[model samples]
Each structure stands twice: as C-alpha cells, then as structure tokens.
Target chain A: MEKVVKILLADDDLEDRYIMQDAFSAINLAHVPFLVEDGEKVLEYLAQMHSDEGILPSLVVLDLNMPRLSGTQTLRELKNIEHYKDIPVIIFSSSLNVIEMHECRQLGALSYMVKPFTYEEYLLSAQHFYDFCLSKHSFPEFNSLINNFK
Target chain B: MQEITHISLDTDMDLVLVHKRTMKLGELAGLSLALQTTFATAVSEVARNVIEYGHDASLMLGIMADLKEPDKFLVATIKDHNNNLTDRINGGLVYARKLVDKFSMISTEAGVEIILHFKIPGSQKIISSRIEQWIISFNLEPPVSPYDEIKRKNKQLQELAEKLKESETQYKELTNSLPMIIFSMREDGELLYANSWLEEFTGETLLQLNVNKWANVMTPEDLAARWEQWYHHVAENKPLTQEIRLKNVLTNEYTWHQLSAFPLSDENGKTLYWTGFIVDIHARKVMEQTLKDNRELQEIKVQMEEKVRELKRSNLELEQFAYAASHDLQEPLRKIVFYSDYLYKNYSALIDERGQLYFNNMMGASQRMIQLIHDLLNFSRIYRDNLYLEKTDLNVIAAEAVNDLEIGINAKQAVIEIAHLPVMFIYPIQIRQLFQNLLSNAIKFSDEERIPHIKIYALNGGKEIQLIFEDNGVGFQEKHLDKMFSLFQRLHSREKYEGTGIGLAMCKKIADLHNGTITATSEPGTGARFIVTLPKEVVV
Candidate 1:
C-alpha cells in the first residue's frame, strides 16, 4: 500500500494561490495541496483535522507576508504544538532578503525559497517542495535550487 | 660753688657733648687723667638717665669747696622737671654715686635734682677770675681728635637705622594683611620672601613651595607649559604675565589665578630680584569657558537642525517612491503582464495578428516598467541601506561586469581594454553595479559606423584614485553635462535609445555614497570619458 503525500499551503493573495495551484497541477504531482488564506487559517485547519482524527498533511508551505498572522508567527505556533512540531515547514516569499531567510530557518523552517515570477520558475519551485517532503530529512540541500534561479 | 658750664640734656648726641665738657672741667680743675675719666664717666651716666627717662632736664658742672673741710670739689648737678627721680634712679645712678666723692638726689614739688662731686687738690688755686678764664678757655677749645666727629656721626647713623627698622616693620604688616599672594624671588627664580597670604592660601610654607618651584600648588596639567613660559620670560628678563590654575589645599580643587612678576632692577639695570603677585581670576575664567562652550553648543544645534530637515525631505521622497512602486504603479503593471500572458497562452486562436502584436507591445511596455521600478527601488535603497566597506580588487569587479554584459558585448562586437587596477576599500556590490552600468551604456550607445570600443584604467592620485572609462560611442554635448546625471534626464528620445534614464543618476549616487565624485568629458559626435574619483581607503 503506497502512502498518500499531502501538502498544505497558506497565502493571502488570491492570484498567487491560483498560480501556485496551476503550477502544482502542471507538474502532475500525485496529491493535491490543501490551501488556506492566512496563518490563522493554517492553525484552525490543523486543529480541525486533529479533532476529527483525520490524517495530518505531510508538509506545510507559508508565505512570509500575510494578514493577521505572519509566516514567522505561524511557524512559532506550529512548532510549539506536539502533534504539528514533527511536520516539515517551508517559507516562500517575494522578498529576496537573506536576513528574513535566516530568521525563518532559525524559527524551525525546513527550507526557505523565493517566490517564483514566471510559470517555468513556479513549476521548478513546486517540484522542489514535493521533493523536500519526500526526503523527510531534518535539513534539506538548497544549493542547486538557488543556483537554478540565478 | 662756681658753675663752669651748663648744657641741655635732650638728645643722645647732647649726652656726648656733656661728657666732653665734663672732661674739660676736670682738666681745668688740675685733676689727673685717671680722675678726669672717672669724673666724666660719673657725670655722663647721670646725664644719660635724664635724657632717657626725664623731661625738661639739664646738667651744670662747677668747682666747689665744702664749708666743713678745706677740700675743693668738682661738682655736677642734674635737674629734671619730673619728681619721679626715686623710681628713675636705676643701676647707672648707683654706680655713678660710687665714682664721685659725694652724690645726693632730692625730690621737690617743682622737679628732681641729682648732684655729683669729685675732690680736687687745694694746691691748684683757682680764684673767681681764674674760673672765669677757665669758662672762657673751655668755650674757645676746639674738638681734640677725629674720634669726636666719628662718634657724633655714629650716633646719627644709629638713629637713622632705628627709623628704617620701624618703617620696615610697618611695610611688612601691610603686605601680610593683604588678601593676595605677595612674594619676592631671587633673580634666578629662587623664592626669597612671601607674606602670610601665601601660606594662608596654599597651606604651604615658602620652603616647601620652593622645593618644587611651587609645583605642588599648581595643577599638573598646566605645569610644563607654564614653566616653559616662565623660563622664557626669565631668560628674556621680561615682565611675566600669565594665567594659571592653582590648587587649594583645603578643597583640593583648582582655581584660575592671574600671576604677574616684574624684575626689580638696580640703577645699573642689573636685576635685583623679582616681585610677583598672584590674584584669583577663577570667576572670570569660568564665565569665559561657559560662553565658549555655549557657542559651540549653539553651532552644533544649528547643524543638527539642518540635518534633520534634510532627513525629513529625503524620507518624504522615499515614502512617495515606495508608495508609487508598491501600489500606484507596480501592482497594476504586474496584473497587466499576468493577464496578457494568460490571454495569449489560453486564447491564442481568437486573437488576430494585429491583436497579438498589440499584446506583445503591452508586454514589452510592462517589462520596461518593471525594470524602471526596480531601478528606482535600487536608487532609493542606496540611502536606506547600511554601507558595508571591504577591500575589493577592481579587476575582479570589472571582469564580473564584463561577464554580466556578455550578451550585449557579443551583439555589438564590443572591444574592452582593461588596465591593471588597484585593490581599494569599497562597497563591492555598488562598485560592481557602477561598472556594469557604464559598460552597458558604452555598448548600447555605440555609433552605427564603428564597432564599440571601451578602455578602463585607473590613475592613482595619492589620496584618491580616478577610474576612467573611455568609450568610442555616441557621446553627448558638453553643455548637457549638468543634466546628464539628473534623474530620468534623457538627451535622446526612446525611439533612438531604449533606457529608463536612471543609470547615470544611480552611478552618481554610488560615487557619492563612497564619498567620491563622478564626472564626464565628451564631444558631441566622437567619444566620452567617464571618470570616477574615489578615496583609496574609506573612513567608517
């Protein structure tokens, strides 16, 4: 029996979410990613899944800037919970700020990636997210991923 | 008794004359030299007592015969208006009584009288007429020896010395009572005398102060320089006037003092000594220092206000730039690019050739807008960003810039000649950006008739280094030099030259950030030389 790979993504922008979805589908990944609007919704979705005794998502992706709760605040809350602490999280942001990336890593993000602008770049980011979940490593290598963007 | 001579017993010099007249009487009375000395000594002692402790006193000398005996006597009588002779009779009077044959003192309501007699030989018959002759002979006698004149002068000198001593005591009291430090020093700067004020103020004696040349009472910080000036003044034999800080022993605090010294010279112009005074000027010095500090503070406050105004203006500009980039401009442009691409990809069958061409034009315009926004953001960030300086090789930065513009260089078939450049302390990223912009400009503005040629070299100008980028390209008129570095100031139209018009402005800003300058020399149709002068080492 093959286990299903489930992913959750949180973003405030509708267009960015749509593009992300389209990029995921274009890559022909086996599982559909669960999407939420902000960091608050991410916590709520996880709490509901825990209450219903449903399967938790395998990986979570977050946009750095959001309304109400930022990606850093959500990551801090998610890492504090016993059931969600083991789940891997990645931060995706439009800002190419090394300081923010380092801060996200310090806050227990498995990886940090820049938001892709083009369709081809989005496709590549989606593939990297899928591979990050499958590897199940504490820290993932991002050298090749960053080099491709350059 | 026959009175031979009489004299007023007034001053000490009168006592000397009394002794001389008594000796002459003894000689005239036929007394031996030994008896003459005894009788003179006895008479002079009584005279001295009258002068020292009596008022309205006189002395008379004569020859007398006692009624009870056949003996002649040389008698001297001393009288004073004071009747307190009993208390006035000191040891000299008792001694004088022993030297004479008879001595007696009587006190009356009118005055006091003292008489002395020395026995004379009867064989020396002196008649009344002979006594008159004796008196006349005494008056006719001159001073016998130089000893008399010398003795008189000595007495005068003693009186003068006494007067001088009294005046000196008065002056010393006056100096000691003064509030300031008064002192005298030797010509060689050794402390000679100081009044009570010196010890009262410094709590140090003249001996202790001279040990270190008053260093203990002075502030150590002001010592060396003050000493230098003092030595110079002494060497030049000039009056010294200086301000110094002196420490108070009780408070252990320093106060400013004005010290002045003048050399006391002799008639021959030889320095005798130096007279100096030290007066407190602490209050005046404090006020002057306070005024100076306040002036400096006022200047600093004005400078701070100017900086704040400049900061506010720049901050407002940054806010407007951010607002336009984030909301007014970039957001709509992003949507247009996104939607246009989506329509072109998903609905290509419904679009005619002209519609596709129009879509392409829209995409091109949006792309250029994105570049413009990005450049504007970079320009604003130059102010917002913290500068990080590192020692960087110019050759590496120039090579990287050439590599970054490789496609443009290939398209234009541009040739770049680079001379060896020095390593300098610089913001590496900004310098690389500057090199890239200049290289790209050289290639893009190449003349149609010639292949693009660029030469980059550095000239070391001691404190600064000038990096020159020479290009054989479509140059500009020299008159437009001021407008060239201004923001969005393009000399040519967009049809001929494709640009956001922020490249040279960004270059100028980068040069300013490094505390450097950027300028260019150009001819209208030939070539351009862009020069950037930068400090060899950046100060933090």
Candidate 2:
C-alpha cells in the first residue's frame, strides 16, 4: 500500500497557477501536490487538518507577495502559531534582492527562493522544488528556527 | 472796594485826613513831624479825591474826642466838597479805614464825609498805619515822582542794544563767509574798517588792506576816480555801482571786479560810513568758453560713429567679394590643370626635358597661387561675425584635426604632444581649423636636423581660457617681432616656406572677437610660441 504524499502550493496569479500545474504534470508531481491562490488559503487548509478526510500535506510552498496578505506577512503570522509553526514554509517570491532572501530566512522561512526572471530558469527552479517534495523526507529531521516575538 | 483794581486810585496823589474835633497840640515833639507827614498825605489824597469824584475840593483839618474820654482828643473829619458825588469816593474811605485807630465815613449832597482819629504813643518814631498810608500810598514823597521817565527810557535803550547785537553778529557771519571783499569807509573816502573777507579774497587781512598802503595793489587802473564817484554817492546818500579792473599779483591777469557801495549813518542825520563789496567775475567769464569745447566733442563723436559704420560696411563687402572672387578664380585654375594633363597625355615625346620642367613649374605656381588666395580670403573674413559657442571636446576635435593632417604628420615624422584637453565652449570647425593650421605649420617648418616636436597645452584662468601652441621649428629673427601679426608680413621667403603671411594675423583677429588676447615669442632657429587667452564667457 503506497501512501499518498500531498503538497500545498500558494501563488496569486491564475495564469501562473495554471502554468505551474502544467509544469507539475510534466514533472510527474500533479498527483502529489495541491494548489491554492494565496498564502491565506494555505494556512486555512492546514488549520482544518482533517477537512479533506484526514489528509495532511507534508510540504507547503509559499509566494512572498500577493494581494490580500503578502507572503512575508503570512509567513510572519504563521511562525507565531504553535501548531502550524513547524510547518515547512518555503518563500518562492518574485524579488531578486539578496538582502530580501536573507531577511525571509531570518524570519523563520524554511527556505527562500527567488522567482526566476526568465522562462527557462523559472521551469528549472520549479523542477528543483518538485524533486524536493518527492524525496519523502521527515519534517522533524529538518532545521527549526524560532521567529522573533515582541 | 466793588472793583478788581488793575490800577490803584486813592494812593495816586494823596490820602484823606479827617479831623472832626479840635486839634491836640504838642502831641509829641517828634510825633508832629511823623504826624505832620501823615496828615499832609491824608489831606493831599482827600483833595485829589475831591477833584476826581466831587465838584469843589476842600481840606479837612481838625481833631476828634476819644469815645471813653472827652478830654483826650484826636483829629478826625471828612474833606468836604459840594457836588453830586460819585460812589468812587470810597477810595479815600478805604484809606481812612486802614490808617486811623477809628475811622468812619458818611456820604451827603456835599460830597462824602470821612472821619479819622490818629492815636499813637508819644515816644514812637513810626506813625500809626493811618498816617503811614496817607504819606506813601498817596505819593506825597517828592523824589519818587521824578523816576517815571527814567524807567521808560531804560526799556527803550535795552531793546535797541539787543537788536544792535543781533544785527552785528549776523553782519560778522555774512561778511567773513562772503566770496568777495567787503569794507566800510569814511564819507571822505578814508577806509574805516575792512571785513575779514579781505583775508580770503586778497590773501591779506583787514590791517593789511589799509587804503593808502594797498591802493596800487587793489587795482592798476585809475581806481581813485572810482573811489571819488563812490564818495560822491556816500556824501549824497546815494548807492554806488561800478566795475574796476584789478590785477592778480600771481597770474598777472587783469580781472574785472563788480563793486557796489552804499552809505551808512549814525544816529545823527549825517553820513558816517560807506560800505562796499567787490566780487571777481573772471571765472564766470571763463565758463562761457567751455560750452564751445562741448560742441566740438559732440561733433567728433558723431564722426566716429560714421567711421565705424563705414568700416563695418566695407568689411562685409570685402568678405563677400573674396568668397565670390575665389570661387570664380578656382574654376579657371581647374580648367588649366585639366588641359595640361590632356596635352601631356596626347603628346608624349613632343617636348624636351626643359619644356616639361617649365610646365611643372607653371602648375606648381598656379596651385600655390590658389592656396594663397584661399588663405588671403580666410584672413580677410576671419572676424566676419563673432565665434559661436557650443559644448565641444577639444581633444576629439584635436584628434580629428590631427588625423586629417595625419598623412602629412607621418610624412614629416613629427612628434606632437597633447595633454589635458578640456571639454569646453568653442567653435568646432574654427577650432578644428585652428588646430589644423597650427599643427600643419609645425610639421611643415621642422628643423632640418632635428625632428619637429610641438606642444599644445591649455590653462584654466578663472573668467578666461588660455592656450599655448609651442613648437621647435625654424623660428625667425626678433627684428620682425612687431610685424608678426601684420597681413602679408613674412620673415621667410616663399622659396624656403610658402605662406600668405596672414596666419598669425587671422589668429589675432579671431582671438580679439572672442574677447581674448594673442601674442607670440620666438628665438631665431629654435622655435616660436603663440599664446592665446580667451575670456571664458565672450563679452558681447
């Protein structure tokens, strides 16, 4: 019996979401990963925990900037909550500032990745993300950094 | 008593002495003297009151009995008069009230009746107030009557003194500062006093200006006659006006003096003094000549403008004529070149070597003449208009100019050094031409033994830009230094180096148009340096 590996992905644009979906199908991760339009819904699905019949995704991919709540804000808020605090949040943002990558990681982001400016680089970064989720690594084995609190 | 008295009435002459009973004699030996004065004063006032208010005045002289003792009698009675009396008879009544020990008054159809009793100690030297008031208030003392006229004269004399002091101070101030000679003389023409203005006008004081001593210094002419006429006026009390010719001791120039004199008199109607004033009218006469000079200067200014316009007009015509003449001349010179080449191609061996040499010389001279004409025209028209400025890189322009003449530069093996060329405000074409002409000349005139080396440097002087184009070439004699920028003034003959001799002249003109300066220094056979300084912002 093979266990179903669920993945949570958040982005703002519909066109990007569709293109990412097609890319996932091409990369053979379509069955394992699920998609949401923004970081807000990703947190909502995680909070339900059993709303989809007890399926808890092992991986969550986040975008840094979006309309309702920006990726940095969502990431900062999620790190504060205890139950969702350990969830792996990788910020895949459309900013190229090296300082921004350093800041996102400092804010307890599991990983910080810059969205590629060109089409070929975008496909390659997504493929690397697809391969990481399929490896089936245990979460507790990864590093945990506590974010700052005021 | 009913009036606010501005002038007292009763004391003006005398006071009333009224005795109603018989007199007490041997009152006191000294008391009668005092009482006598008192009684006289009172009686005089009573008489005066009688005259002023009643019709017929009378003196009242008697005695009065004391109220307690009939034997002790004092004098008391009204000075009687007969008429309808005025109410003003109270002047004497008031005198009697303050004087006697007991006094009373009653008015009747026979004037007013006043009664007074004078009582005092027998040893006393002072009389009672009744007697004292009667004597002094009525002016019975005779000496005080004479002082009235003296007081009036003293007041008049004081006012006259103050007025005379004020006028004297004003006269001193006016005379000392007046730009003339002022004097006062006796009516017979003897000088009395000279104002201190003589010190300023004649460089001599009043004492030095005595009439007898300085008569000749005052005027060379017959000024005695002038003084005679002036005296006639003072004697007749008429004004004197005249102009006398006087000589300046230093300049020896005779000057005309405007003289005016008038008579002054003492309190007596006799003429006592004559005052005169003299002013030099020479300077005022000289001012009239300056107006004529101003007119000539104005005429010269107009002529200068016309000359500048004529020069400008002729310059424009000359530039256009040069451009047109050169264009027409170049057409025929080109045809001559084409026909000579055509003849050489058609006839190969028809001419000797000498004929070929003659033809080459002809072509060479023709080409040289064309270049000379071109240069002559460029010099004539260099200052046609002001140089136009735009942002320019002199290095780039210099490089391009050097490249344009690079073939010649390489042919001469000349070493040119350029350093720190600025991005500046300049005319690209003109500057390029400037660099081309300068650089080419440096290469063309290289020393036969040494390689030609040229330096182009610029210095930034605030409000101006300066440049130096220096070269180690065959420089000429210093004797021709003054003519370096003159048109067609050349040191080297055409055989050695070909030039129209207008290059330096053109450089000078271009520099001037930009509100700049240019100069040259050279050593024979060594080199020449052309220094140019241009204002950073050309003055329009």
Candidate 3:
C-alpha cells in the first residue's frame, strides 16, 4: 500500500501560488497539497491539524516575505513545539541574500531555496522538491541534496 | 633728704676717684651702660683741669630728688679756689658740655664752680619720697677702690661682644635652612652669599660658582633674549622674574628654572645689591607640552570622523536613486513584458504580421531595461549594507563563479586557465561577482575566427594581491581604454555588441569597496587584460 503525502504551501502572491500548483501538476506527483495566503493562515491550519480530528502535513513550504507574520517567524514558532519540531520546513524567497538564508538555517529551517525567474526554472525547482520529499530525510540530509544539485 | 660725696683733685689718683664716683652715681640712677661711661668721662676732665689750674679743687657726686615729680637726677659739682680759668681748662669745658644733659659754671670771687646733671632712666612713677631718699644714701658710699671699678667696666665689655656673636650665627642659620637658593651680589661685582640649597642644586661651592660668568650655564637659545630683558630690568632698578633653561652639573642636561630678583637700595635710591631666589620648574614645563600634543591629536580624530559622515550622506543619495529606478520604473516595465507576451500568445491570429513584429521588439527592449535596473541596484547596494569581513579563499570564489557560468562557457566554447590563488579577508559574494563579470565579458567578446582563451591568476604585490584576467577576444582600441570601467559607457555600437554596459562598472565598484582598484588594457584585435589589485587586509 502506498501512503499519500500531504504538503502545505503558504504564499502571499496568488500568481506565484498558481504557477507553483501548475508546476506540481505538470510533474505528475501523487500528492495532496494545501494552499494558504499568508503565514497567519498557515499558523491557524497548523494549530487545527495538531488536534485529533485534523490531518497533519508531512512537509511545509513557506515564502520568506508575507503581510502579517513572516515565514522565518512561523518557522521559528513551529520548531519550538514538541510535536512539530521534527516536521520539515523549507523557506522560499526572491532574494539571494546569503545572510538571510543563513539566519533561516540557524532558526531550524529544513532548507533554504531561491525563487526561479522563468517557468522552465520553476519546473526544475518543483522536480527537486518532489524528489527531496520521496527520500524521507532529515534537515542535514536535505543539505546534501542541495549540494549534489549544485 | 640728699647725700653728697667729695673727692680731692690733687693728683692723677684723685682724678681716678672722681671718675669712679661719677660711674657709681649713674648706676644708682639706673642709666644705661653707654650713658654711664659718658657721664664718668665728662666729670674726670672737668675735675682734672680744676686741680692743675686752681689751688684747691674738689668733686662732689650727689642725687637730686624731686618731691612732686617722679623724675630724679644725678649731679656732679667741681669747685676750685682760683677764680680765673686757663685756656687748657677751657678746652676740657667744651668736651664736657657735649656729653652731659646739663652743664653750668657759676663764677664767684673765691672760685669757679661747675655742675653736671643727667636724668635717670626708670619707670615714670613716684614711689614716694622714701625711694628718692634711699638713692641719695646709696650714692654717698659709692667711692670704692679703683681696682673694683676697673673690673666692673671690663665685665660689661665682655657681655657686649658675646651678644654681637650670637646675632651673626642666627642670620647664617636662617638662610641655610631655606628650601630655595637665596643669593646676593654686591655692588663691587662680588658674590656675597648663597644659601646651602644653591650648593646642593649646582653641586658647586659659592667660590667655585663664579657669579660674573653665571650666564654661561643658561641655554644658548634662550640666553640672548632673556639676557637682554635681564639687563634692561636691572638698569631700571625694577624687580625681575624670568624662566630659563639651566645646565644640571650632574647630568649635564638642561632643566627649566625660574629666577626672581629685586634690588636693595639706600635712602638715595642707589642700587646696593641684587637679592633673588631660584626654583626648579622642569616638571611643570614637560606636563604643559604633553597637554598641547594631546589636544592636537584629538582635533585630527574629530576631523576624520566628520569626513566619514559626509561620505555616508552621499552614498545614501545614490541608494535613493537606485530605489527610484527599481520600483518606479520597473512597475510599468514588468507590465509591458507580461502583456506583450500574452498578446503574442493568445491574439497572434488577429494581429497583422507587421504589428506582431513590432510587439516582439517592444518585449526585447523591456527585457533589456529590466536587466539594467537590476545591475544598477546591485551596484548601489554595495555601500548600503554593512560589510562582513572574514578569511576567504580566492580559489573557492573563482570555482563558484566558474560553476555559475558553466552553461554560458560551454555555449561559447571558452577555455579558461586558472592559476593558484591566495586567500584574503573580504566579502565573499562581492568577490565572486567580480570574477563572474570578468569571465562573462571574455566570453561575450570572443573572436570569430579563433577560439576563446582566458587566463586567471593572482600574483603577490607586497602589500597587495593582483588578480589578472586576460582574454583572447575582439579587443578594443587603446583610445577607448579610459572609458572602459565607466557606467553606461559603450565603446561599440548597439548593432555590433549586445550589452547594457554595466558589467565592468560593477566590477570596478566591487573592487573600490575593498579599498582596491581595477584597470584595463587592450589593443585592436589582439586581446584585453584586466588587473584588480586588492589589499591583503583592510583596517576598517
């Protein structure tokens, strides 16, 4: 029996979310993805999923910049909880600032990734994300994946 | 009651009795020792003259007591039987007149009588008639032996000599114990005295320190000016004070000393002697110099800080320019790219062939415009952010830049030879950008007939490291060399070369941030070489 992996995507831009969904569907990965507009909604969804009645996600992908609570703030808050500390979080931003990326990693993010400029580059990033989840590895193992791609 | 004693003036021995009786009367009247001797000498001269000239002569010593006033007097009377006095006796009368408080002679038919009176010095109060009566009775027995009188006068002389010696010792001790040098120079060009402190300071005795040549010890640089003022003040008879450097005999080093002097003059205002004190002032002079140096250094530091603040303000204005180009311009530009692409995709059938071609050109121009804005942002943001410095390997930075441009390198088929590079303290991202821009420029301007060849290497330049990038490409003319690294300066026409002309400018800006320089050299159709010199370490 094959287990269906649930993924959570939090972004502020509607067009960016649409493109990401199209990219995932184009790759033909067998997965369930939940979408949210901002980090506040992301926190709300996570809090509900912690109870017995809701479903918990296997991976959370967050945009670094948002309207209310930022992605780095949410990632730090998520890592503080005992139940969600082991769940992986990946930060995505338009900036290639190494200082911000280093801060994200220090705050217990699973990986830090840059946004693609073109649709073809976006497909490649999506394919890498799909392959990363299938491996079922921890945060340090995720760093190895980025180095191999590099 | 009054008592009187008489002594006959028959011989020299009688004259001696008259002198002794006179001194005893003065002592009983409480006169000073000097006044007592004056009274005795006057009585002896008058009595002797009377004996030599007059046939009968006698001396009477008595006390005159006042019943009402507290004052008492000692009186001497000499009488002779001969009436006429000789010229020799008149000479004695003139000498006796100046010594006594009162001198009178009464001429009678029988003889000449002389009387001398001297007021006694005592408490001005009447102690009743009984005290005056006792004084008269006491003088009546005062004609003692001549040997006893000679012994009493000799003892008084001995006491006076002892008092003069004691006063001289006290003056010497007072000057010796003073902390500073107290000196006096006499009018006849002689050094009179210097206290013991002067000997300790100069390590020379008073006789050895020749006062006439004292100016030789002063520093030559200050001597001429200070000596001129010294002589001017001395001639005017005014008090003088001066600070001068003097030579220390032990170390032979010049030390600052303060000398102050004033003239001692008589009632006629004649300059008698120069008296002064000398004090050590070297420590205070050194401290004053230290304070002046510290104030100068503090001023220089403040000026440098002001220059840094001015530089920061200009850099902030450049950042504002970058922000305007990014957001205010890119907002409209992004829409053009998005809509043009959309119109070409979904509405290509409805548009004419000429309109579709124009739309394609519009998209191309907007895309290039976006790249220009992005490069400008990167250039201006260098000073906008704080620089983080660490030990970085230049080889690693080069490898990363090569990896980033691997696809472009293969498409152009460029061959890059990298030599060993040294590690430096620098910001890693900016250094990588510098390498990437230089390498891509080499690939972009490749020669049509020949393959592209590039060499990247570093050489030590003592205090700096030189990173050289050489390329075998279509080189530029030597005349265009000065414009190579300027922003938006294009040497070639847009039809021949496709560029925004900001790559080399970005490389130059990055080098400048590290306190370094980038220079280019080229010849037509030969090659181009760029040399970037960077410091090994940066202080700030």
- Each prediction's RMSD over C-alphas, in Å, is 19.7, 27.7, 18.2
Decide which is better by TM-score, 2 or 3: 3
Query: Per-residue lDDT of B78-141 in model 2, one digit per residue for the tens?
Result: 4456535545776555664565566666777655666555564443333244343443433332
- Lowest lDDT sum, 10 consecutive residues, model 2 chain B, at B1-10
Model 3 bad stretches (over 4 Å) = A1-5, A18-31, A118-150, B1-304, B313-350, B380-396, B407-415, B477-482
Per-residue CA lDDT of model 3 for B385-474, tens digit only, reads 666887999899889889989998999888989999999999777888899999988888889888899999998989999999999999
Of the candidates shown, which would achieve the greatest TM-score relative to the real structure? 1
lDDT of 3: 0.77
* CAPRI-style class, candidate 2: incorrect
lDDT of 3 by residue, A50-107 (tens): 8756768878899987888899888888889888888888898764444566678788
Interface RMSD of each: 3.9, 31.6, 5.1
The 10-residue segment of model 1 chain A with minimum total lDDT is A141-150
Candidate 3: docking tier: incorrect
TM-score of 2: 0.48
Model 1, B349: alpha-carbon shift in Å? Answer: 2.5
Ranking by DockQ: 1, 3, 2
**Model with the higher DockQ, candidate 2 or 3:** 3
lDDT of each: 0.83, 0.64, 0.77
**Residue B99 CA error for candidate 2 (Å)?**
14
